[model samples]
Every structure is written in C-alpha cells, then in structure tokens.
Target: MFFDRKELTNDQLVTFYRQILLPRMIEEKMLVLLRQGKISKWFSGIGQEAIAVGAALAMQEDEWLLPLHRNLGVFTSRKMPLHKLFLQWQGHPEGYSKGRERSFHFGSKAHHICGMISHLGPQLAIADGIALAHLLAGEEKASLVFTGEGGTSEGDFHEALNVAAVWNLPVIFVIENNGYGLSTPVEEQYRCSQLVDRAKGYGMEGVRIDGNNLLTVYDTIRGVREYCVREKKPYLIECMTFRMRGHEEASGTKYVPAQLFETWGRKDPVVLFENWLMSQAILDADGVERERQRIRATIEEELQLAGAAGPADFTFQDEIADVYAPASEITGEIPGSDRELRFIDAIKEALDEALQTHENLILMGQDIGAYGGAFKITDGLADKYGVARVRNTPLCESAILGAALGLSLEGYKAMVEMQFADFVSVGFNQIVNNLAKLHYRWGQSADVVVRLPTGAGVGAGPFHSQSNEAWFTHVPGLKVVYPSSPQDAKGLLLAAFADPNPVLFFEHKALYRSITGIVPDTAYQIPIGKARQVHQGNDISIITYGAGVHWALEFATAHMEIGLDIVDLRTLQPLDYDAIRQSVMRTGKVIVLHEDTLTGGFGGEIAAWIGEHCFEYLDAPVTRCAALDTPVPFNTTLETQFLPKARLREAIQRLVSY
Candidate 1:
C-alpha cells in the first residue's frame, strides 16, 4: 500500500491521489445505481484502481492503450469525457459505440484507447498490430495492453508476445494478476509460479510490481515504456492486484474467499494512496472527505448530461445501414485489357500494383516473404517490395489478422493471405468477431483484404481445399469476393483492396494457374457487387461464381443448341439481385451452380432468392447443381464426382426439359 519507490514533486503526488480516487469513486456510485435498478451492470475495478490509473499517467498520450472492461481509470485519466462515459454505461446515443455496444467495450480513436472486447484475448494481438503500425511508420510510439491472469492462458497471449519479440515491436505487456478469473483462481489458471515467468520463453524481460501501490505501477510502466521505445522491443510486467468486486454486479463474488476481501482490504489502492497523500500533507481526514465530495459532485453533473440523452434510439433501417458500408462511389478510371494472365498471376499483379501505388500498403502471412507462399502466389513480391512491406509471419493466423486490423487503424492498407481457406478457422474469431463487427460497433473502417486460397479440385483434401466463401457471406460487415476468371480476379482484387471495408477475396487454387484470361495491364477497379453475363441464351439460365463459372461456361459452349444462359455473380455479400432477377425472368428456369456442397452451400441462397423474387416467371422450380454434402476427398475419382462438374450437365438438361 505504501511505496518508497520513485520520488515525485508535490503537485505530481497530489495528481496521483486524484487520479486513483476517480475510478474508485465512480465505480462505487455505479454499483449503488445497479442495486437501485437504475443501471444494468458494472464490472468493478475497485481494489485494483492503482494499476489502471498509474498506467494512464505512465504512458504517453500518443501511445496506444488496449485495456480491459474494468479499467475505467485509464479512460478518466486520459481525460475522456465523463458525460459520454456515463452515456456508454446508460446505453445512450452519445456513448463511444453510439449505444451499439454495452458496458465499457468501446474504444475512442480520439483518446487513443482500444478497449478490450468480451472475448478478451484477441486485443492483445491487436495491440501488437498498433505497435507494429508504429514500427512501420518509424514512430517511436509504444502500445500498452492489459490482461488478467486468466487471459494469459489464451493462445493469443503466446502468439502476441512471440510476434512482438520477433519483430522488435514497441509493446508493454501488462498482466494485472487479479487473483481470480471469473471465480477460477489463479492457481487453476496456470501451473507456472507467476505469469511474468513466461516472458523469458519469448526472449523478453519480465518485471513484477505492486499493483496496489499507485507509485510503483506508474514508475514501473514509465520506465519500461522508455526501454521499449529505445530498444524497439517488448517488455512484460505483472501488476499484483486483487479484484474487490465480482466480475460484474450480476455475478456476485460468493465464490471468492471472504478472507481475501479482508486481507486485500489492508492493501486497498485508494486507502493506501489516501494515507500516503495525508502523510505528504496534501490532505487530512476532513480534506479526504471533501475531495471525495468534490469528485462525487463532478460525477453527478456528468451523470445529468448522460441521463439527458435518454435510451438508445433503435431503428431497423439504422441496424441494416450500419452493417456494411455502401458501394464505392468513384471507382477510378477503368483501364483497357492488354494481356492474358493466369489467375495466380492476375492476383499477384494486383498485389504488385497495390504495393507500388499504396505507400502504406503491407502484405503479411505465413511463408509470404522470401519463400513466397505455400502456392508461391507472393513469389518475388518480397524481392520487389522490401521484406518489411511483404512480411512473413509466425504460424499464428489470429495474431497476423489482428495486426492487419491494427495497421488499418493506423491508416494503412493491409492484405493478409491465409495459406488455405480452411486454415482461416484458426483466426476465425479475429475475422467474424473483430473485423466484421469493428465498424458496426465503433464506426472505424477495417480496410483489409484477406486473400483466401479456396475451392476443392486438386485433392488438397479437407484442410487445404474447401469452398469456404459461404462461411463469410453469412457474416455482416464483410464483403465476400469470389471472382471467376483471371480478368475478374485482378479487377475484383484491386477493387477489394480499394474498398473501405473488410473483404475476403477467395482465390480458387484449382483455377489459379490452370485458367488464363485477358487482364488489364494497368490496375482497374471493378465494382464489387456487379455480375457479368458469361453466355446468352433463352431457355435455362445458370447462375454461379468461382470454379462453377468455368464449368458452366464449358457446358454452355458444348450445348449451344440448348439455349443456355450463364451469369457469374462476382461478389457474394452485395449480390447483384438485379442481374439475378433479369436472368430468371428472361430464361424462366434457373440452375444455381457452385463448387460448395449442397445443403448449406451458397447455391441454396441463390435458388431461394430466385424462388422468392422470380416465382411467377419460373416455368419450373429452381434447380441446384452443387458438390455432395461431404468433405472434399483425396481420391481424384471421388473428387471429380463430389464436385458440381459431373452434375451440371444433368441439372441443365433436366431444367431445360422442365
């Protein structure tokens, strides 16, 4: 409780007293409000105010902070508006997430605070991303992240720390060992004697400090921050603190031993700081009460403004509008087509152009540097653009994805390639939870393009080959681009990179080198949602995208007398419904073809859309030609039968006759 650490001036000592008291006082009032049924919930950082407050005073204003839900001291110390902070708790429109998110789960770009989400661990890697951005921009800024002892057990913790150490990124990994992780004690969390001990495994120094001591937290963090920036390396620190209240008011701390509150009460951050302040002659007993009253009055005034905002205004249209950004307005000049290139070459061409054109462009993935990539799609890119721009990452997809999100926050265009589409499952949380919901929750553009080497044909089997585009189309706030040809692949990729949203650009491995088409010599943006009519006919229409387009084209050419029409729906999320309606209306019969298996495949979506919108125009029920509902097999014979290629002809003939 008492610190004999770094010496401070009179005003500095007084400042620490006020900073530590602020969150403690505010949290107490909110708990009262919760008991009175005025507020829904509260995550109390009551006993551990010093760590958050001290870190706030320690880090530079420009330095990025990724704090957990309970660290209200960081917000108040950063001078975040108390009115809006209260509004966030009240779920008012003026809150950080505009009332879209509950609790202190929102961050302020203005304040440079990146709040931790409910999932908790991914933000550690996200902090790495912010630090990585600073490193790339040649800024000496460091990123500080807070995690509880339990959070250290997550795989992201290991990935983030290793990545930071390897890249020499400026990041301060602060573990607030709050003893219990939602009632699971620290002893149960890890077998290690202390969380700081893991730092050596990542080739970094780790320090332990008294989290309850206000002066110690500030002094330790300030010193470590200097070291991080000077050396451009990561440092780990463990703040020994205790959670005074339950994780949330709703979940009572009955599971916590009663003696902990008594024992830790002696080491209370506020009580210790207040006694230390009185010893410094900053305040007496009466002065302490007056200071508390003064802070309470300030909170009350801010609460009035926050309460005036009323409940959040909810509208169905606003919900839909916030899901994804609208189509890009100005799509730059469309250059003429000049050369025929393979699908892989076209994608590489787009990446090459992006690196040349975008100064802040960065390419990150596993084996993407000198060795190129698993398929060599990024071959020679590292040679052309330096290794820094075309970077290889550890086999940690979640961390890399989070880093890309962080870079995007720093106004950089990041392109991340997943070795295989199925491998994306490893980083699925970063995509579906963070990347997909970042803008919709906090109004920040995640301008990242995730290149997916997808589809099944070359017997790469389950892990390597899978048509996983449908997996992302189901999630909002992400644009799903699955181009059919080398030409479309190049234009769509360039367009995906230019668009201000999270995009999953699915590159079918089966077509990457096998297919070649005329591509533009100069980079051009093809509007994402637009579809192109591949073949014109009258009787039956085949609508598809990705590998299915090639099969449909072959069939269209082979059975020219059957009068078949083919349409390639380029982007899945912002589907070209107009094109779909027109095609179904003209042909009267439709066959939705796709490489993904039946049942949950995207073909069902298109067929359902046709049934819903073009019911009257249809001469027969909409048919579907898709792979069997099973994982792609290794055997070529079975793989051929599993795909829609074998079924396309039968489906088209049946639809034409019907």
Candidate 2:
C-alpha cells in the first residue's frame, strides 16, 4: 500500500529531510566553487532533488541505479561518501572514475550504480541489460534508471522500453519531466499532453506524480519496484517538476521564464517537506535549522578535503592501458590435439568452449538463437546453452551494443554479433562513443567482443557486405582482430574474451565456408597483437590480413622464383611493428594488400607506418593493392572484377622485381 505523508514516522521524515538537504547544499557549494574558479562545470538538480532521493530510497541496496548527472540526490541517498563526490568534482585521482572523467561521469561497483555518459538515452538500454542479467541469474532485483523528458525523445529510450516489455525484464524507468530540456520547453519538444501517455505504445504501466511531493514520489517508486519484482515487468514513472536553475552554473536563468522560476520557487521540495514535518510536530523549525547547519558543515569539510587532494598524474600509457590484454594471461602454448574444420565451425567451437568455461560469457545477436545467426556460425550454441545465454535480439543494433556495454559493467562478457559488418554502421555511435571510450573515459573495462561478419565474395550487395575494420582500428580503446585461417579465428576469439577491453572480431563472410584448416580441439588463445610470418623469403615483403592473406599465399606459391616474405597481421590495432620492420629491412621492398577500398583502407595505415619507421630500409616505393572505389556489385562478373586477384599479383610482381 502507498503510504501517506502523515503515515511516515518521525525518523522517516527526518531521514528524507536530510537526503533532500544534502544535494541542495552540495549544489549550492558547487555553484560557489564555479564562481571561485575551483570547478569547471556543474549540472544541478536543485528543484528536482526529491525525485532522486525518493527513487533511490525506494530501491533496495543491491538493486542497480543508472543515474544521470542531475541525480546527485540519489548518490546522497545511497550513502556514497560525500568526500568522493567532492573529489570527483575536483577531478582528483582518488575519485570514482580515477581522475579520467569530470562531474557526475562516475560509477561504483560496490554501490551497484552505473555511471552515465553525456549521450543520455543510451543508459536506458544499458539499464535493460542489467535487468536482463538479473533475470538470467534469477536475482530478485530491479534496475532503477533515471532520465529527463528530453531523453525520452531519443531513439534508445523507445528501444529500451520495447525490449524490456518483450523480454519481461525487471526495470523501473523514471522520467524526470522537469519542464525544460536545456532551455527548450516541453511543449516545443513533444506534442503529447503527458509524457507518461507514451508508455501505452510500449505496453508498460505508466504513472505521473507531482515531483515536489516527496511522499508521493517515494511511495509511487516503492510500489513500482514491488510490481516490477513481483511481475518481472517494466514500469515508467513521469515526475512533473521544474528546473529552477539553468542547465549549468555558467548558464544564467535568462532562458528560463522569470514567472516559471517564481512559480516553482514557492514549491521547493526541501522547504515543502520540512514544513510538513513541522506541521506534524515531527521536527520544529529549530530542528530543521540545526539539520541544515549539520549538512552545511559536513559538506564544507568534505569540500576542503577534496580541495587538498591534488590531481592525478596521468600518462599516455595509462590512457591506453586496457587497449590490449596482458601478455602474461596467454601463459604457455595451448595444449591440445588438432582437428580439421571449416572457418565457421572453428569460430562456433571457440564460442562453445568459452561458454562452457566461463559462466559469465553470453552470446547475443539477431537470428542467433533458433535460426543460428545469418550464416549459422552460432548454429547449435542456443540449443546447448539455452536461450538465456545465447539470446536473439530485435533488429535494434544500437540498443544491442548499448546493452552489451551494460552487461560488461555488470561483470558479464558479452559476445555481440552484427549479422553483417555493414550493419555495424547503424550502431556505430555506441561502438565508437560508448564502447570504445568507456575504458579511456572512466577507467571502466568494457569486456565486450563484437563479432562482425565482414567482407564480400558472394553476390551480397552494399548493404550485406563491407570491409570496415579500418573504422574500428582508428578507435583507440578497441582491439581489431581479423583472422585469415580457422586456427587464428578460433584462437584470437578466445584471446578477445580474455581481454579486459572491447574487441572487434571481424569474420570475413567469404572465408566462413570456403576456408578450412586444422584447429586445436582443446581450449587455447593466440596472442592478440602479434603477426604470423606465413611464408619467409628475402625478395619482397607482402603485408596482408583476412581474406587478402589467402590471396597473397596463392600468388606467392604460384611465383616461387620471386621470394616473398608474407606477414599476416592477425590484429590490426596493435600492428606487429617489429615483424614488419624486420621483414621490410630484409626484403627492402613492400606490398600492402586488402579487400577494402584502395583510398582509405587499413593498408594505407600499414603503408604509412612503414614509411615513417622503415624508410631507411626501403628499396622501392611501397605499393598498395585494394578493391576499386565503388560499392560491391550484385553481378558475379563485376564482383570478381571488383576484388581482382590479377591486380594483387601485378602489384606483388612489381614490388618483387623492384
């Protein structure tokens, strides 16, 4: 039953008063710091503190909280050390994000709180993933996610809700509909009379409440939590409130109407709750004043401590620490017998072994469950591991990737599959902005491996076929793996899962069925940033990866007279510079080849690296052979001409005869 304001005990009222007061005092102190040149920026939740406090208090200690920058009251209610919050504001090394992020861009694993990125709505899907984890683990806990009215308009918001509804996930989505979305009023944003009304479309229960009413906010969220836990369903609560202050400390209240502030100013949540307490004789005016003084003193001391704590000494090495897994983890060579298998089967076997070994590993993709993915690469995984671990998701690429990030945060390693590499563009924002930057931004490990079925040989057109490894290679925090042989494919995937960072595993569609090699039956991992010298010779150096490796091997075997030193770069991000240098120095000539467009393929990166580091060892200008600057055609003749073996052979001959 929902509790009335009068029903709350004296201790409960006093506790709520303190929870609301803490964030108010903190925001006020931060504004002072902003003017004093001590802090950089501040996003205050001055008038909306009640919503944060109420929702946080309603949730259990173990239930996860996905909070936005304006939800400081939630942190206060959760008993997050005030000094840590101050340290975060000061960007101290001891802060939750380890001095990497600013403001509220921090999370605590101990507290079960997932920090948010500036791109607001992605957290919605991430919260769903956390809820999914809870469901899979049979944990009786729900995830409480906070977003604003502006965030509701984002595509991820709808996608998160839809997925939660379809899967019956336990999540309570709270929308703090505080009149303005960074100066753009609600009426200008969406025409709906009430934001809660949109929940009908997503098949979830929706409720609206006066956000300034602390009792109502807390009771509503408490009830929602019960319903979610009991029914395993998602709920949305739209709290009506106003932004009394500007978006940030630097932004003045000029954009906000003077009348609106004056109207909301009278309905201040802290003052209203305090007045109710006094009316009930729970706490007199003097008691409230004493409480305020105590909070002010506490905040002052915490801020002083934080100010004394200096900034962290961050080096470039620290910034890129999690880019690749530690070499020590690979240990000795993989001990096992070899079995001849197709490239597709090798990848499936690797996934099966990983699932069988690690309880935290999960596979998610479209058609991966019943249909066994687009290429049947994950054919029997669902049947073996059950649908929960091997999940089939809706055609929401961005949401799927965002959920993978959340799953990673919750200590699960997610292997997400993009049916085709070209479709990765649809989810490019999450991959680059969220997945790639998590480690760099907050020192948070994104243990996600995105399996992309890439490249073209069959009659698949532009939408189905693409070689987009270069895009991920450019991202600093991501590890790019494209294996040519079945052995490398199986080994590298195992390495990726073991790594702490995000890895983009590019599985060339052309090599799936056509390529077969001996793969170890026992569990093993190939080192991520090392290259294999497939063929050793001294005349010319052939640098290639993925399907291009096969082409290079074919050409080198055909022309035995020309000694070719072929280097197959299994990992693209951390290129084997030592191997490349030695081969180029010995051969004195180099040929870079790939299936991507010649203009901006990863080959260009290889050529540039060689030019910068191996310039003295060069005998001839480095030559690069790649696909023509056009989309892959549907016609077989044109497709064959598009990826010409003769072109690569001619380039090799020119380099060899140089």
Q: What lDDT score is found at residue 322 in candidate 1? A: 79
Top-scoring candidate (TM-score): 1
Candidate lDDT (C-alpha), each:
0.88, 0.87
lDDT, candidate 2, 363-458, per-residue tens: 999999989998988888898999999999988988889888878877898989999999999788888888887766666788899999998898
Q: How many residue-pair clashes does candidate 1 contain?
A: 0
Model 2 misplaced regions, further than 4 Å: 1-3, 322-328, 334-338, 644-646
TM-score (C-alpha) between model 1 and the true structure = 0.98
Best by lDDT: 1
What is the Cα-based lDDT of residue 360 in candidate 1?
90
Model 1 lDDT on a 0 to 1 scale: 0.88
lDDT of 1 by residue, 16-36 (tens): 888999998898889888888
